[model samples]
Every structure is written in C-alpha cells, then in structure tokens.
Target: MVDFYPLARKAEVLHVPMEVYLMFRAAGGPDILGQSAAVSLLDWFELDTEIIIVMERPSPSMDLVTYSTLHYPLPEDTVRDIMRQLVLAVIDLHNKRVFHRDLKSNNVLIQETEDGIRVRIISFGCGCIVSTIPYTSFTGCLSCAPPELFLERKYMDSPTSVWQIGGVAYELFNEDSKFFNTYEWFIDALGMKTSITASEEGKHFIQVCLEESPSKRISLEELERHPWFFTTT
Candidate 1:
C-alpha cells in the first residue's frame, strides 16, 4: 500500500465531468472501467506523489465531481527535465511490466520544489498491468492515442506511451498541440498544410516516436539520447 499526501492544503476547484465515463458506460464497459483504473496504474509505477495532488475538495455543485489546482504551469526548461525524469520512470515501470494506457497533459502534474521541478504522472483510473489487460478496452486521450489503438484491434501497448510522449515533446517545445486546437485542423496540419517543422534531428526523433507501427517507435532509452534533449540544456 502507498501513502498519498496532500500537496496543496487548499486550492480552487474546477468541475467538468469527463465524457469518458458516459461514453464507456454506454459502450458496455470498454477495456478499462472508471477513473480508478487510471489511478491504480499510476500507483503501480510508484509515480503517484503528493506533488501531483493539489487538494481534494468536494463539489456538490456538480454531480459526481472532484477538483484540485496546481501551483503553477510547468516551465519549458522544467518540462525538458521532467520529460527526462518521466522517460526513466516510464522505462522502470515497463521493466516492472506495467503500462500507462492513458498518457496526456491532464493526467500528468508538476510541482515546483526547492530542489527542482517535481513531476507526477497521475490518473491510473484506467491503468492496468500488461498481462491482465483490462476487459474495458481503448482508453486514452484522442490526440495522444496512437493510430493502432483506434483501429479495430482495441488493445494498447508500450508504444502508445511513445506516441503520447512525442505529443508532449511537441507541446513543450512549440507551446501548442495539433490536438488542442481542432481535430480537423490538426488533421489538416498533419497532412502538410502547416508551417511548423523542427530541425532534422528533432523532426526525426518526433517522427520515430509518433510512428504508427509500435515496432518502429523509438524506445525510451533511445529517446534519452536524442539531440533535442541534449540541445535543450
């Protein structure tokens, strides 16, 4: 059992019932069930820290809701550091045979500490061990999800993390996401209508990380050595 401490004793609340519950419940319990699964997954990795939890406040105003707020937005330089930490943390989780089926900014949290930026990947409510493989299938943020996950197969693996991490890297460096603006716009941008383009090394790294085929995606260890990371420092 792990102990969860409160990061912020008091914080503002934002209540927005996620659509995943309604959509999955209507679908007859897709791969994973409820937010607990996501919370559980993060626990297995031992990445659930107080730094990730601002405060847990009851919100009777909204039906079935909870809210918390962080101290500040993660800085760009700090984002790079946390990305490195996450890469190592993720590799360790995989070694333990766990997979974070759902990876997204909303699911990740950051805390500023005297030592440095502390990161905690939260919301394992949809998390599952690689072997158990939840009966509730297809859990992930639409933008970060790899193409294969959306296909008829309905199963996700480690590479899913790679793609999502790629999306994170793009967001951290560019301050925008293809998925955040508009679905159609993101699609059109991916189709080569956008002016955005990273350097050769950065482009190659992102491309490999976002590869549709899991086999082609770069491993976390490989990502550690990417020039983008080194160049940032």
Candidate 2:
C-alpha cells in the first residue's frame, strides 16, 4: 500500500508507522482474529517535497468508512465483532508503546476473509511514541479530536486514545456524525441519541468511552472487558 500525502506536509511527517511495525515485529506480538492486525511498513523515503510510504496492501480491502457505508446500519452483533477486533488492535499498538493519535474510521481497513471480517489499522502519519507526559498540541483530525484537547488544551495518552476509539464508534453508529465537535460530542454522548440504533449495553459502552471528563473515560483494559463485547442479541 502506497499512501500519498501532500508534499508541503512531508517535512513535518515522522516515521511513526515504520517504528510501530518494527517494534511490534520485534516484540513478536500475536495476530488479532487469526490475522496480522499490524500493517507492515516496508520502507519510506522522501523525494524532494513528497514522501512515498511502501506498505503491505491487503487484497480486496476497503476502508472502514466505505465498508460501513456499504453495509449501512450495521447490526449490533457485527458491530460488536468489529469493535472487539478494533479495540484489540488499539491495545496492541498501545502495548507496543505506540500512540496512534488519529484513530478515526478512515484510518482503518477492512478485509473479508474466508473465515470472517478482519480489520487492519492504517495511517500512522499522526502517530507518536507513547509517553507518560501529556501532549499539548493535537495532530489529528479536528472534528474527530477528543474533548480534553478543546477543554484543557492538553491530552494525556490513555484518555485521549480511548476517546479516539469512542469517536470511531460514534462515526459508525450515530447519524450525522461527520460534522461533530467536542461540544456536540459532549451533549450527544450523554446518552445514546435516537439516531443511534444499538442495544442498551452497546449504548453504554460508547457513552462510557466518550465521557465528558477525561477522568471519567474508560480505560483500554476496562473497554476490552466492556459488557457490550460479551452481549449476544
């Protein structure tokens, strides 16, 4: 997979994606859902103004946005399976000490295998090394950013990462989520809006992930254990 980014922004880009692939490979992390969740970055080099990234391209894949739009109004069980893999993918990155600050729907790729649907997280352009220190500047899609970035002007690792995961869910489950902001997210996430079609447990999972206060947001561990993942029907 070759991703093309604007030449103007090439100078500012870091090799976080490459770093993540390498680290995960070195750690020998197991695959998620019987397939490699990590998108391997073969190599990258800048040419004058633009940067060309060579990565592994999964056969017959589409981004999550396209996938979800194609399967519009995805059922809760399918959403549950997808989210389980997604959260696990996120946890895998965090475990490798990588922070994919921009974890929106567009960054995820979906592959339909003989067994089942598989998800691969792509685009580490907005990623960074995980650190205990908070990030004062945000490097992700503005509308997809978390409330802590707007409210406190700084975002820590766990809270912000968890929020981004929730943002992905919002995009999948909520109507008219394309133009959202933190304020809108604040009000809409208080509870599952009528536009969101989901079970009570699923609704609660998203609500907990998008809590207004950073302190109130769910941790990755808690998210994996969320009841929604285990709910049937």
Candidate 3:
C-alpha cells in the first residue's frame, strides 16, 4: 500500500506527519519487521509537497470491517483466535514502545491462510510512542474512543488500547457495529445492561476491557492469559 501525505497542511513545520512518524519507527529498531500483527513499512520518501510511503500489500485481504460485515456474529472460536492475535500484536507494540492510538476494525487487514485467518494492524496516523506521561490529544473513531479519552481528554496508552480491543471483540461476537452509540447501546453495555446481552464469558471479557477506571482496565498481558482463548478447545 502506498500512502501520500501532503505537507502543505502543516506548512510551518514543513514535515509530513506520516513521514516523521515513519522515521521514528525506522529509528525505533528493526523489531517491527518481525511483528506479525503490524503492517510492514517498505520504503518512504519526501517530495516537494508530499510524503510517499510504500508498504507491503497483503494480497487477497480485506479489512476487518468488511470481513465482519460479510460474516457477522463470527463463530466463538474464530473470535477467540482473532482476539488472541490482536492481543499478541498489542503486546509486541507495547514492548517496542509503539502505541497504536487508533486501533479499529476499519484499518485491521484480514486475510485467510491455510491454517486460519491473519490480522494486521494498520493506520499509524494516530499512533505514538509510549511514555511515562499521559496523552492529552485523541484521534481515531469516536465510537471506538475510550471513555477516559472522551471525558478527561487524558489517557494512558495501555488502558485506552484495552478499551478498543474489548469494543472490537464485543462487536464481532454480537454482530453489532454500533460501538460508538455511546448515547444508548454503549452506555448499556458498559453498565452490563440487561437489554444488551452477550455470552457470560463475552460479557466478562467486555467488562474487563471497558472498565471506566483506566487503572483497573485489563492489561495486554492479562488479556493474553484470559480464559476466553482456552474455551475454544
């Protein structure tokens, strides 16, 4: 995939946001290349007014959104596998000091393999590095945005990511895409609202992800060890 970023928007800095972002990744280390969950960056160059980025194209792949829309309410085992991969990816990113602030179904590429399905996280436009300090600015889909980000505009990398992951999991399992319908459905889901239901395991998992208190939210490590993945057997 080739992405073009116009530098004219932020003429003062004269640096393309994406170009700078890629530069950081390039400097961060070569570990990204080994991460199965992230889309690999191939090459990037700067033009007069645009930054061109070349990335690996995952052939015969569709985004998770399309996949889910076509195959909503995916089987429990399928969802478990998907979450396992995603959690593994997030763990890798966190370990590498990269935070994908904008993780949603739209940018997650999905391709079927001989063994199973593969998922790659894309769209680093809203991503940043992990820091001891909290981030104040937020990006990505409002529906997938965590409550802490919306309410306080301040969020930590790990907890916020947990929320999105949980939201995606719930959406896939329930075949409901109104993740951002915070006014009604989301509010209910957070409350474990009786009207909006899921499997007992599903509900427990979602609750852990959507915990209102960021500090109490499930960590990537904890999620990886969750019982949900073991249920498939």
Candidate 4:
C-alpha cells in the first residue's frame, strides 16, 4: 500500500506510520488472523513537498469498517468470532510492546478466504510504544478513543485499547451505530439501552470493555477467556 501525506499538514516531518512499520518488523513480523502485517518497507521519497511511503500491499482485502458496514448487525456468532480474532491481534501487539493508538475499524484490513475470514492491522500512523508511560498526547479516531483520553488527556495502554475494542464491538453488534458521538446518547446506551438485543453475557462483555475506569476495564487475556467467545459449536 502507498501512503501519500501532504507536507502542508504539518510544519515538521512526522514519519510515525513508517516508524511503526519498522517497529512491527523488529517485533518478530507477526501476522494477525492469517493476514500479514506491515511487511518490509518498500520505498520512501519526497516530491514537491509531499511525502510518499510505499509498503507491501495487502491485496484482496477490505477494511473492517467496509466489511461491517456491508454486513451490518452481523449475527452474534459472527460477531463473537470476529471479536475473538481482534482481541488476539491486540494482545499480540501489546506483547510486542507496540501500542496501536489509532485502533479503529478502518485500520483493520479484512480478507475472506475459502477457509474463513481473516484480518491484518494496518495504518499505524498514530501508534506508539507502550513503555513510554504517561501518554498525555492523544491521537486516534475521536469516536473510538477512550473516555479517559477525552476526560483526563492521559491514559494507560491496556485500558485505552480495551475501550477501543469496545467501540469496535459496539459497531459490530449495534448495526454500525457509534458509541461516543453524543454525551446523552452514550449515557443512555451505557445504561443498558433498550435497543440492545444481545444476550446478557454478550452485553457484559461489551460493558467490561467500555468500563469508565481504566483500572477496572477488562484485560485482553481475560477477554480471551470470556464465555462469549467460547460458546458451544
């Protein structure tokens, strides 16, 4: 994939996406859900104040946003399956000390095969290292960002990621409805909104992911063990 960024957007060069691709390579070049991540960097150049970054193309794929929008309100089983893979992908990134700060549906590339649907995380433009503590600078899709990011301007890695995962879950099960656009609507949704038709366990899973307090949010490891992901076949 080729990324073109106009230099006019910022006064100084910010090659965060390229840096993240390099970081992913250094961290064992992992693949999530059978799709490869930012592979070897292809090329980089500047032309007339525009920066171009060339990367290995993840062909024959669509983003999660596009896929979900096409198949809105996916079945509970399908949602559980997709969420399981997504959680595992996030866990892999966290274990490698890489924090994909801008984790939204658009950043996840989805590919369907005869075997099954798979995914690869892309667009690391806003990613950062997890060890770099006290992240006061917030960067990511505003709607998917955690409450702490909006409320305190600082957030921990695990909790913030959990919140973003919850946002993804919301879109998956809520017919592409966003979670945090308006304060009143969000409050109503959080209070177990009437429109929610998911099972109690499913609701609990999302609720844990959207926990207001970082310390209280569900960890990826715990999420992996959640019953929703282990329903009888």
lDDT of each: 0.49, 0.74, 0.70, 0.68
TM-score of each: 0.58, 0.82, 0.81, 0.79
Across residues 121-198, which tens digit of lDDT does each residue of candidate 4 receive?
Answer: 776667776764778877777767777777788888888888888777766767436544324336676443445557
lDDT of 3: 0.70
Query: Residue 67 of model 1: what lDDT?
Result: 12
Worst 10 residues of 1 by lDDT: 58-67
| Candidate 2 global TM-score | 0.82
lDDT of 2 by residue, 1-233 (tens): 43432222226643433443443442332332224576765556667666666667777789988998999878878888889998998888888777888887888888888888888887776777788998999887887788778878989877887887887777777765463456666575444356666789977887798787888899999999998998798
Q: Write the per-residue lDDT of candidate 1 for residues 1-233, one digit (tens) a residue.
A: 33332222128342212222212222212233222212221111223341232222112221101111122233445555766766765665566555666666566555444665444555544544555352336665665666665564554566767777776655554423333222332465565323334555555666677666667788777887876677652
Model 4: number of backbone collisions: 0
Which of candidates 1 and 4 is the stronger one according to TM-score?
4
User: How big is the RMSD of model 3?
Assistant: 5.9
State which candidate, 1 or 3, has the greater TM-score: 3
Q: What value of lDDT does candidate 2 attain over all alpha carbons? A: 0.74
Best model number under TM-score: 2
Least accurate stretch of 10 residues (summed lDDT) in model 4?
26-35
Which ranges in model 2 have alpha carbons more than 4 Å from their true place?
1-35, 175-180, 187-192
Query: Across residues 1-233, which tens digit of lDDT does each residue of candidate 3 receive?
Result: 42433333224433445534533452332345524667776666667776666666676789987897888656777777788898888888788677887777787788787767998777777777788898888766766777887778798889988988987776676534554343344446544344334567766787798777888899888988887777753
lDDT of 4 at 33: 22
Question: Can you tell me which runs of candidate 4 are displaced by over 4 Å?
Answer: 1-23, 26-41, 46-50, 179-185, 190-192
